[model samples]
Structures are given as C-alpha cells and as structure tokens.
Target: MMLSEKYLQIRKHSEQICEPLEREDYVVQPIVDVSPPKWHLGHTTWFFETFILEAFLPGYQVYNPAYNYVFNSYYETIGNRVIRTDRGNLSRPGVKEIYQYRAYVDAAMLDLLKAPISPKAEELLLLGFHHEQQHQELLLTDIKYILGHNPLFPVYSTTAFKLHHDQTKEREMISIKAGIYEIGYSGTDFCFDNELGRHKVYLPEFSISSNLVTNAEYLEFINSGGYKNFTYWHAEGWDWININQISSPMYWHLIDGVWHTYTLAGLQPLAVQEALTHISYYEAYAYASWAKLRLPTEFEWEVAAKSFDWGQRWEWTESAYLPYPGFSKAAGAIGEYNGKFMVNQKVLRGASLATPEMHSRITYRNFFHPQLRWQFTGIRLAK
Candidate 1:
C-alpha cells in the first residue's frame, strides 16, 4: 500500500477513537502523565499542517493562529510551545471542536497526498505519519497513566488482554562473541536521528539474559528487601526514593499485603512471568547491581538485538544516549527531534508492547531520564 493511503486511514481512525468522549475528557489530563486528548488530536494535525501542508499547500490558510505556539511540541527552533506539564489548562478548544479542526486538515491532507508532492513535502508527510503514531502510542500510555490516578480508577477500553503464563523455563545467560561490533541501522528505511551510520566498538566478553526480567523475578527483589537495601540502588536513585519515600513500582499497590496493578483493561493481579515494565533506568540499574548483573551498553544491546526481534518491549541498556560518532543533524527544525535529547538520558533498545511492529527496528535508540518511567521500560540483564 502507498504510504499516503495508509496514513489517511490512521489519521481518520485516530479522530474516531476520541469522538465518543465528552468535552471534559479531552482536557482531563488529571496529572503530568497525560496531555489533554484534544491537544493530542490537534497537535498531531498541526504536524502535517505546519511541516507538510504549509510548505506544500497552495494558498494554505493557518487554521488557528495560536496553534503554532500551542501545538509546537518540543521543537526549539519552532519557537515557544504550550507547556506540556500544563496541557490540562487548554479548554478553549472543546473536544468536538478539535475533531472539526481535524476534519478540515484531513480533507486538505488527503487532497495534497492525491496531488503531486515534492520529495521534501513527501518525506515530511511520512514523518508526520510516524510522529502521529508515536503520539497514538503515547495517547494510550498517557490515558492509562491519568486513569490510574483517578479515585474511580475508570477503565478506558473493554478489550481483553492475554495474561497467560508462558511456562518455558528461563534460559541461562548466553554469551555472544565479544569482538568489535558495528551497531546502528543498516537499512535505508526511515529511522530516528540517533540510529545513524553503523559504527564499530570493542565489546568486552559478556553475557546477556535471553529474556526480560519477569514480574515473578522482580517479586523476589521486593521479598529480599531490594528497596530497603540502599547498597543496591544508585546514589541518586536512593535519594529520589528517600526524598519520595518510594516503596515499589509506580502503578503497584499493596492492600493488606497483597499486590495488584492498574491497567487500561482495569486493575488485575500482577503476573509474575510478565515482563517488568514502567521502570526507570535508575531502578533497573540498581536491580541489576543487586543481582550481580549489569545493563548492556546500547552498543552491546544493538549487537544482541540485531538478530532477534527488536519489536518487543523497549530494553533498558547501560549506555547513555548521545549523538553517533561523526554524526550531523539534518537541516531545519526537524533536526531538533533527536539531537536535543542526546544528553542526560540513557539509551533503550527494542520496542515496547505498546509500539507497533512496523515502527520497531534495530538501531532504533529510545531514551529517557534515569528517574523517568512513564513508558513501557524493562531490563535485559547482562554480566
């Protein structure tokens, strides 16, 4: 299928999902983990309107003047943007209104895609599609994060999930050759800026676990006083836990000494064999240290995942995310996406359960601050 046709379907379906919600739900951020659903709807449209439509559409009309500022998410070159932490404050554009706005843009975008598109405009449109997909994934994460805090703890969707335990015995740590390993995307397909120019590095002789750390295994950590022992945690992690008086993963609850977790499908008993998720790098590092293991460096992770499917949950790695060696950012504001986030965060390998299979690939480096854990993050331990 042509990229344009597929994107149109996704675009329309995205709007359809929010149509059933009331005006209030669009802005019901509830906390920092969510953006107003209205904002997500419009901001995604703004990407096409700003990056592709404005540049390509003849006699293009800017739908909302404030949209440039309101929808510009994290593009430093694009000037100031609406505050992400305060996304709930946006109430001027009601939920219904955003859908109308989306409809107008969708008609225009489809029209443009039907006509001839310049190479630059076409690439931007493709980028816009993937950008929307990212937000689509975030839309789920953000809504779940918000609903988790609600007193009612409302369930968003009634879709059933698979919770069956895969009884395959855990594999022992497997050793891969520790020679010089070239890591990065080898294909010409679209990828984020971080995974550029396959490069070489000397990998020390080490072994990585065949699978992710399970919920059952993590239970052992808690049983063994993992949080109570300061030595198992990083200095900063310990301080964060102490200052916050942290006890367990964010979504976990201990009611009368029994464990449970909240999910989009509603609260359920925590499954032990399920991959441990929504964990910060600090906590992952600490737990690995406790188990006499280390998180694989991003290079090592790429070397390992290069053969396996990188479409699973995002794997926590030992390397801090940074620009590739001899890498240069693409020209224009789009360059802001990956280059700006190159510092103060660790690299993650593999996709999450939330990510679509089409978007996941080796050398796709996802990163977050050591203490942040709002997404599906888990560890693949190494020694």
Candidate 2:
C-alpha cells in the first residue's frame, strides 16, 4: 500500500476503536495512566500536528494553538504543557470539537502526503502513525477501565465477547539450552528506538510455558490462598495488597460464588481456559514464585519467542526497562520518547489483544509501573 493509504487507514482505525464509546465515556479519567477516550483521540492528532505539520508543512495553520497546551503530553522540551493528571479536567474543547480538530489535521496530513516526501518528513510521519496505533490499544483499555468501574458497569461493545472464547492449544514447556544469542530488532522495517543497537546476551538454560497462564490456572492460585500468603509477594507488593485490599484481578467480582469479570462486552462469566489478563507485574511475579518458577528476562524471552505463540497478552518479563547497549536518545522533544522512561518500570514482551498489528514486534519493549494492571497483562512462567 502507498504511504498515504497506510496513514489514512491507521488514522481511521483509531477512530473506529472509539466508535463504541458514548459521549460520557470519552471524558472520564478513572486513573492517571488511563486517558479519556476523547483525550486519546485528540492527543494522537496533536502528535501529528506538533511533529509533522509544524515541523515539515511550512505555513501549516495550527488547529487551535491552545491545543498544544491542552494536549501536549510529557514533552518537557516542547515548552510548558498540561500536567498528566489534569487531562480529564479540560471540558471546554468538548467531544465534538475534538472530532473537528482531528478532521482538520488529518486533511492537512493527507494533502502533504500527496507530494514528494523528504526522508525526515517520512520518518516522522511513520512515527506518528505508529504512535496513533499505540493509543488505539490504550483507547480500548482505558474505555474498559472507565466502564468497568462505573456503577452501571456499561458495555463498550458487543464484540468483546470474542475475547472470551477459549483457546484449544495444548499447554507445554519449551526448553532452551544455556547459550549466548543475538537479541533485539535487526530488520530493515520501522522499529522504535528502544529496539535499536542489537546486541548479544548470555542466558542460563530455561523452560517457558507454551501458553499464557489461563483464568482457570489463576483461579487455582486464588483458591490456594495465593493472596493470603505474604511469602508469595514482594515486600512492596505485600504492602500494596494490604493497602488496596485486592483479592482478585481488576474488574472481577464474586457474585454468589460465581467468577465474573467486566469486559468490553459488559459483565460476563469468566472464561476459565482463556488467558488470565489485567494482572500486574507484582501479581505475575508472585504467581511465578508460587508455581516454583520465574518470569523470563527480556533476553531469554527474545531467544525463545519464535518457538511459542505470543501477542495474546503482554507477558511480563523479569527485566528493567533500560535501554539496550549503545543506546542513545534523539536530540529534541522526540528524544523524550523512550530513553527517559528506563527507570522504575518493568518490561513486558509480546503484544496484547488490544495491541495494533503494526505497532508490535518481537523486540518491542513495553513498560509500566509494577502495580499497574489496567492493560491486557498476563503471566508466562519460566524456570
């Protein structure tokens, strides 16, 4: 497909994800990490404007100059911006106005793409499309969180029933002998900067589960008093358990002894054979310990990934989110993308059901605070 067609398709998909949301659904921010569905719509549009239109399209009129202040996220180099937590507070732009802003920016983007593109312009444009795809995943997850926590427990879409279907793949462990191996993305296609500077790493012999931990398996952990036992949890994790009083995965409820969880399809019976999802790093770590196994390091995961199926859920790995060897940041605002986030975050390899097909690759490194369980996160055990 041509670059222009690809750009339009990606942009359309982002909007398609938001189609199920009600106007109210687009405005709520239940947690700091989860932006409003509408905010996601606008912020992605802001990215193309701030990076591509302003950078390359000379005489490109800014679509509401104030949006830069309202939508700019975490780019300290780009001048003063809204605090991350305040994204939900902006009520003036309204949902309809944001849609207008998106249409306005997308038209300019398509017109620019029609002409011969410079290497720099093409690079940023591709990055913008990839960036939108990241938010497409976020849009679904955030919408889930917004509805899941509501008193009404609203359904985002009926199609979410597809996620509850059981997987028939037999469970097995794939063993890898200890050895040095090449890791990280080396392909010529577009990849994030974090996947760059491919390098070699040594690993001890290990075995990894063929499938993600299922709801039935996690239920066993719960039935065995996994939450009650402190030994299964990290020091901080134990503290979190006591403070938050978490007994089950997020959105789960024990209604008269039946296990049910809120999904995009609304409340439904938990599928026991389906992969356990919406779990935190702390939970993943604790479950591995309970099973007398461990989470794979990012390098170990990369080496064995081809041998098993993934992309069902983002599997937590036993690795910090630091840059690979010889990694460097780009000079300006874009530099803030991945380099600065290396601290205090756990690495998750593989993609989730909500992840856009083009946005994820084998070397893609996803990170979040260990306690965050909002994304489509699950466990894959290693030993």
Cα-based TM-score, every candidate: 0.94, 0.98
Name the best candidate (by TM-score): 2
Q: Give candidate 1 regions above 4 Å deviation.
A: 16-23, 160-169, 306-310
Tens-digit per-residue lDDT, 1-383, candidate 1: 77668877778656655544545567877666568777888899988888887889898887887889888888888789878887788777776777788888888887887867788887787788778878876776776677777767677666532322232455667788869988777787787767887788998887878778877788888889998999998899999988988778768887777888887667778866777888888789888988988898888777776444344467788888888887788888998878877888888888776764377777778888888787878888888
Query: Tens digit of lDDT per residue, candidate 2, span 39-63?
Result: 8889999999999999888899998
- How many angstroms is residue 111 displaced in model 1 relative to the true structure, after the best TM-score fit? 0.9
**Candidate 2 runs further than 4 Å off:** none
In Å, residue 326's CA in model 2 sits off its true spot by: 0.4
Estimate the TM-score for candidate 1.
0.94
Worst 10 residues of 1 by lDDT: 159-168
